[model samples]
Target: MRALFNDRGRAALDAAQDFCTTDALAYGPLRSEDLTADGSSLGELMTGPVLGPLTVANTVGFTAPVAPVMIVHGVHDASVEIEQSRLLAQRWRAAGAVDITVREFDFGTELVPEFDHTATNVAAYPEVIGWIDRLVARA
Candidate 1:
């Protein structure tokens, strides 16, 4: 998804970028030595305030919407793991969402490695359109 960043969003992005660069330089490159060191800076980066909070928030159970929901995830997506969508589907089912479909496309079957995030809209365009058409027909 794309975000229309206003002033606050831009400021947050700038701050995150600055923090990442500074941390990377201070900690040096990610190596076995660095990871197994006394204080794991890479570990800190992974569990830091920015990423940690988002990770927790995503996994936390919440009341799902009372509407038909379709979740599509690429099996080989490196950016966002497929488990994210799986967990979301679980939460939706628990929250009483009746018409929820969780679709997964294997690597190079219905998705491409290069278009990890946009595979649903790009490589699987026809399937997506067909899904929407079926949903509309049901409605």
Candidate 2:
């Protein structure tokens, strides 16, 4: 699910962090299973605004000017599924986004063939910071 709505994954984390009043949530690369849940949460948050008309525009339209988006997820992220990212990438491509890059890394729960989710294994700071730096510089 996190993969499906990579756009809001971080936002949900932010919300959760604020709501929890602590940094209990973790971030890192993700796996397919991790996405099923995390992706759903993020999607819900994003679509909530869209469907509830919380934003200026009520729907996802091509005319909306959006900046380039960068997503970084761990391949072994058990909290969110890796496939979610694939789905989102497809949607963004369909939406005519040229600079969207979803970077997948290897830092999360141990690789189990049939697992759905795993615990975060590493701090996703350096790489994430680098990506954000590049994006900001480009912007």
Model 1: lDDT equals: 0.61
Per-residue lDDT for 15-117 in model 1, tens only?
5566842343444333422332234344454465555666567654477777777778877776568888898899878987788877887765333344566
Q: What is the C-alpha RMSD of each candidate to the true structure, in Å?
A: 9.2, 10.6
Instruction: At residue 53, give the lDDT of candidate 1.
Output: 69
Query: Which candidate ranks first by TM-score, i.e. highest?
Result: 1
Give candidate 1 regions above 4 Å deviation. Answer: 1-12, 15-61, 108-114
Clashes of each: 0, 25
User: TM per model?
Assistant: 0.55, 0.44
What lDDT does candidate 2 reach at residue 9?
47
What is the number of residue pairs that collide in model 2? 25
